[model samples]
Target: MTLSTVNPDFWKGRRVLLTGHSGFKGAWAALWLCRMGAEVTGVSLPPEGNFSLYDSIKDQLTLNSNFIDIRDAEKLNAVVKKSNPEIILHMAAQALVRRSYREPVNTYETNVMGTANLLEAMRDLAELKAALIITSDKVYRNNEDGHAFRETDPLGGDDPYSASKAACEITTASFAKSFFNDKGIPIATARAGNVIGGGDFSEDRLIPDIWRAAREGESVTLRYPGATRPWQHVLESVSGYLVYLQALAGDDGAHLPKSLNFGPQGGEVVTVGEIALEVQKAFGIDSNWSLVNSAQPPEKSYLALDASLAHKALGWQSKWAPSETLTKTVEWYKAFSETPDIYSFTLSQIDEYEDIS
Candidate 1:
């Protein structure tokens, strides 16, 4: 269940093309790859927020970062062709649910077409050994049932964001079967749970919203307090992807599963209200939340993932429990608020995670 399966030597001098390296999860992956001594080329738009993990570490790390949209097939293909990456990790997408509702076209273009563009671009790259397309646990159909979704669960989504990711799963699978399989290239899709961690300044997310409310000394708004999610640290999810990629590197397209779920253990599944309370406790702040009584866009009331396939296939499992995940998140924000050197603080957290995982 630990990160012993991640071989550091396997990444040294490896050519890796990472899309969406400007986002929260992508930044963490970029840093991890850099730490492993991988020759990394990051492609994505510039960081959206003023304070971003990508901005914090981009100057220090040796990464060839390109500011381009994944939806642009021409530009994406050019970058992919030039990099000639052996491994491609596609993380770029319109990730926010609320934003997806507001910009459905953008969501589909970025998540669905963006995935197709990445796969299409890979067709010319004869050097491509493997590719891991990052999708969401929301890709699974949720009927408000409490059952944890496995990799075989039917792909469905009610919201724009989830639907786009579900479409991505289908797109990746089609590409894998129709193209990559014949070319001896292994391609897989990773469905990870609701990821929470440091350096996430994104809007609408529970942790970031709570942190912002607390800092402003205002009550936080809860859209779906009773909604339950399978939560895990950023490191846990990133480690799962790394382990899955490593597995794909050696295997042919025949044996590897087309899709794998990477989520926390059973104990880590918790309600939104419970996580809010946990974050308040961790931050030593008085709990104040106001429920949105108005009608809003529909979202899954309950979501969890069964990552048994990843555990059995790649020897990967979540390391931190939900409580520790919240604690570490609070600590990171607190450190950033108090200290000027966020770069060092973020690196220390990564080092600590590796030590224990």
Candidate 2:
């Protein structure tokens, strides 16, 4: 019983429209898809922040790059029409939880309505066969009772980010049933766990926070030391998405489920504090962290996902254990700090992952 991989033969010479290609996960996906010989048309806002993975490696990718807001329906529709893609991977969103608190309206607009915009734009593309809407594991209502959420679990959330993603899932499902299914296109939404990897310089994330602390000679402040999350490398979930999309485009794909979950398999629950210690060990630095004494917004104390369906249906399993994931993640940050050819290092990591997958 071996794990499956993204078939490069299927991707060769395929037309793909990838939104959010300027973000962390999107950048990795763009590079991988291009390496597999897919002609990618990228639609995303220009990279923000001084240090972004996309900015570091954009020059190395050969995509039809366009910088536009997904919220702009007219422009997005124009791009969709122009691209005439066979497959679409929609990952654009305001993806930070803490920032969603300050700008809840913007978050909802981007996660919910923005999803609708993409669906609307692509529905009429005669060449389209399949699409995957990327959501988060946090879309489920967290009872915090140490329950592993299944695909059939009730959807609700307290924070703006999670709630908006839940809404996005619902919206995409509606479009899938009402439009895509009728049009003979297999469209599904995928919920993934907390993805950690190199090149994620986004604010309010674990690995990037730790890297910043090491650079500044200070300890990263912890908001929820006791909270548990399902952690996996970004490529694990990305490859899962690619594999599932290929399945959907197959002859029997229309009979597949409309939504699937991708997360680390089994009862591998590690707390935030424990992961912090492991990452510091990989960095060869002291486990330096202290709790923030000030009041902060509420967060889930325990969260996990049941990826049994992905295993049964797609035969998908996470290849890297927590230790290996941490080692590779830390190694990437170190490469960024010490080396200049990040594009080459990133490609090597991708090749390493493919070798094992």
Candidate 3:
């Protein structure tokens, strides 16, 4: 049951409506779809700091850019209705956990209610073939144990952001059962572990902070020094999402409307200290990264995902090992800073990913 790599013609001329097209993962996914020849309509807020990759590739995409928040149901519905997209990839959310501690209300509203708004809007859309809602691996209740959280495990979260994502999982499930189930539009939710990649300018994430500090020749600060997590490059998770959609569309009854986690194989779980060491090796930097707040906050102890379901069901397995993940990520940022045709470089990566089969 090996899954085939995505066919470029599968996306050729397909209508794709992508939310959060300005964010790191969203921008990458949008560029990938565009390179596959999809007509992309990007809906997102203006980039806060640097120019988004979506903006960099705007001229190359047949896109209708919408500057609107997903929390606004009216605007969300209008955009989806007007675009009349064939595929909906909902990636917009308040994604930072530490920032959630500061803006709890905004985090809950965006992750939970924003998902609700997206589902409600697409309920009546006749043209939509599939919808993939992105959640986080933190949606599981963490007991600080070493057990890998399964999809059937109880969904709970200690912090605002994690809880909001958990709520989104619940909301998506309810919507699928109550509305989208018998309506022919396939709705699925994806919960993947922490995604590390280039082009991520967000605060409170490890890889970007490491990249920033290394680029400036400074040491990085770590909050949870000993915490272990299932880390993979962003493309791993996004590829899983695209594969899930392809499975749903091609087999019709092959995929159930349930939540799935995309992560690396067993034994790939590495601690924060180990990853920091790897990043230092990758960057050719020899320096000490300070550990702050020795007394750990209420963070997960060990988090990983069992991607066997994805393997057996979709024949999808992570191709980029941890070292390759780090190498490719760091290389992208370095190249992006100097590359004149950034869009071509970005699209070229998508072409490479698609050609891997």
lDDT against the true structure, per candidate, is 0.88, 0.91, 0.81
Query: What TM-score would candidate 1 get against the native?
Result: 0.97
Candidate 1 local lDDT, 106-174, one digit each (tens): 999999998899899898787888999999999988886778998888989998999999999999989
Off by over 4 Å in 1: 1-4, 251-254
TM-score of each: 0.97, 0.98, 0.94
Residues 64-178, model 2: lDDT tens digits: 9999989999999999999999999999999999999999999999999899999999889999999999999999988888889999999999999999999999999898888
lDDT of 3 by residue, 113-208 (tens): 988998999888888888889999999988867788888889999999999999999999899889977876678889887788777878777877
lDDT of 3 at 240: 89
Using TM-score as the measure, name the better of candidate 1 and candidate 3: 1
lDDT of 2: 0.91
Models sorted by lDDT, best on top: 2, 1, 3
User: Which candidate comes out best when scored by lDDT?
Assistant: 2
Tell me, by TM-score, which candidate is best: 2
Show the colliding residue pairs in model 2.
Answer: none
Supply candidate 2's per-residue lDDT for 115: 91
In model 3, pairs of residues that clash are none
